[model samples]
Target: MPRDTPPAERGQRLAVYSHSDKRVVLHVRTNAITHLPPAASKDFLLLCPHQGVGEDDPAGSCPRGNTCQYVHADLRGAHRTTPHTKRGAVAGFYQTHLPGSRWLVHLPVDGECPPKLAILPSRCVLVTRATPADAQGSLPTACPHFTLRHRCDRGVRCRYVHAVASPPESGIQPGRCLTGGWQNDPYRAVPVLQSPEFDLTEHLPFA
Candidate 1:
């Protein structure tokens, strides 16, 4: 028997380690993500543009530095689906500026293990254990202008919506008509035929 073992170790019960028995691992997070281990490429899907940007850069456009300003992680799927599902694989990790020294990660691994904004062990595995089927299906919403014009000027670069808008059930048309007064203009109006339709030629300026 080990000398450290107390009288309880000699009993039939197995030895157990409590949460305090484990060593607390601390990870030194940085803003520079270029040097980090190669993981999934889900940056474009992230709503928070600041994921790959520097801590001081609010625009999220500056070049990558030596440390990460946002939370970053490698996520897999949990293989479950629910009506509330809204995110995809791990997109990033961010640290809170509060005094509690909190950390957060984005996206879920599978439908079951959805990504949550919670504090986790700093030294925990970077990659989650999930392989989602529709992992790459998280697309941004379509812009309002996209609904009127089928073609979007911003194309894929537009961060706004890219989907179609549902028509209102009230029957009242939404948005101002682009034709405006042109539809009522006499010069631009189509010529009305006699007999077949009410002859409006009398009102024509050339009549």
Candidate 2:
């Protein structure tokens, strides 16, 4: 099994949000996201901005990063057509950062996995849910949450790789909205904006 790797060795960009407060509790890694791997803990819930956890918990609230509480929120295993569950702490403990891009990846390996890709001036691109098309044409459209923002560590322009289906379906669609979960159900994130959408936003205007 994978033991706890050192912070530097792991090289991941993980974010933790407190469910009850909706605040980014602890953020790991950095602006460089190119490795993002899943955490080996029970906390750390994966998230997709487009596939919001219902309007009540649009921000996800880090279902897995409850720190002391560790509330499960009792979410359904599959994408159920129900209202917001119990608001679990959205988890983002990572093994690496994918860099650039915006929009969370759901770790699927069946279809195109049209992630929300971002092209930064620094020439870095990955996936995340921070960029918005209305801001600059970088993001395809507002994420399902519609709260996250575009952020880059180097003051750059980011675009959304995908996002079409108005109200995301959790299932695969075409054009705008992108579906993940092609290989593993692991969720990954790349810093996109300097806003609170990302964990760093809690610190300040991200680069």
Candidate 3:
């Protein structure tokens, strides 16, 4: 099991096969993986609903004007008229604000399952997990691009990385000027000692 995998997704290796076209009979959303092969399990590709916008960039634009590129699949067929028309596959999403973009998770294992059109449980929606800063459980680092407005919009949905934000720097404290200056002197009568020895009148050029 990968260190970053969520507890919900951490299941025993129930089966393993080399066939690329084979579909593993299980619904990740329903926790109904009883049909998995009884053989020693190896890494397998779980079909994710978050197929990002296809090559048609404009086709994936959300109707709510939010910048969601991933399609919200209608796994239950809640809004499909024809089998060809994907239920959740609407032209554009009505949400004006989806917190973040969906991540494209490609497992590094060999013989990973390719995308397939199979019905599965709805609860199996894939959510991203926090990246490990190190194996020692050190604090996770945030996505550098996340600070930019474009990246911040993705919030947790980003597949890259996230972290607990540090508190903003406190406003500069009001302090005395180092150069010894005053914006306003309230003491109208500042005492001054007159130097009798140094006469400015005698040193004057006109004198």
Candidate 4:
């Protein structure tokens, strides 16, 4: 009679699959393989209930509205749908103050899942100013055409500078300057330290 191996030695060793990091179990008797499911995490995508169903009711369809906790559907594609929860029908809607800005009333949607918004950090461009001491060196000048009308007639040939804005230093919060005027007002030009000089005739049609 063959001697029985110890209880610990009788069981097959569990191996981990390098690609997926999931544990694989091997049955010694049948030579069968089984993979254990990955652990559940909050990072998983949360599908909206009203998705793929139809257009959400304009009056009110989702009870959570802006307060829905799970991730929302994408807004850019045709498959996108306004998020609506099945808990209770109230209103299905979502809105943001600015493009890429945080949701006004939404919470978890900003921090969790598909429509994650809170992770986006505020950014601004730092325009370098010309000083008398540095007149000898070449420096970038803000494009007046781009600043006033948000377009440059010269395109790439324009001598003016077009600086890309970015987030400020550590501990420094980024915000719009409302000192000169409301930044959102379309009629008024954006506030700036020094306005660039340009010929009025260049922009005039008859000139």
Tens digits of per-residue lDDT for model 3, 97-149: 23333221111111111111111111211122444334663322223333112
Question: In model 2, what lDDT does residue 173 have?
Answer: 30
Off-target runs (Cα >4 Å) in candidate 1 are: 1-142, 165-207
Tens digits of per-residue lDDT for model 1, 66-169: 35333232111101111000111011121112232212222111112212222222222122221112356332212333333322333334433322122222
| Per-residue alpha-carbon lDDT of candidate 4 for residues 1-207, written as tens digits (9 for 90 to 100) | 112232245344221111111111111211221112234222222323433222233114446655544323322111211111111011111111123321110001111111111122111111122111135532233343343333333333444332222112232222334444423332232333332322122221111
Residue pairs that clash (backbone atoms under 3 angstroms), model 4? 124-165, 124-166, 125-165
State the weakest 10-residue window (summed lDDT) of model 3: 77-86
Cα RMSD (Å) between model 3 and the true structure?
A: 28.2
Q: Given candidate 4, what's the lDDT at residue 87?
A: 12
Q: Candidate 3, 111: how far from true, in Å?
A: 38
Runs with alpha carbons beyond 4 Å of true place in candidate 2: 1-15, 18-21, 28-207
Maximum-lDDT candidate: 2
Worst 10 residues of 2 by lDDT: 81-90
lDDT at position 99, candidate 1 = 36
What does candidate 2's lDDT look like per residue over 1-207, in tens digits? Answer: 112232344344444333433322223334321222344243443333222332333224544343323322222221221111112211122111254544422211122232332223211122333333454433333222211222221111222222211222243232222244321321233222222221212221123
Tell how far residue 187 is off in model 1, in angstroms: 34
Provide TM-scores for the models: 0.15, 0.20, 0.17, 0.17
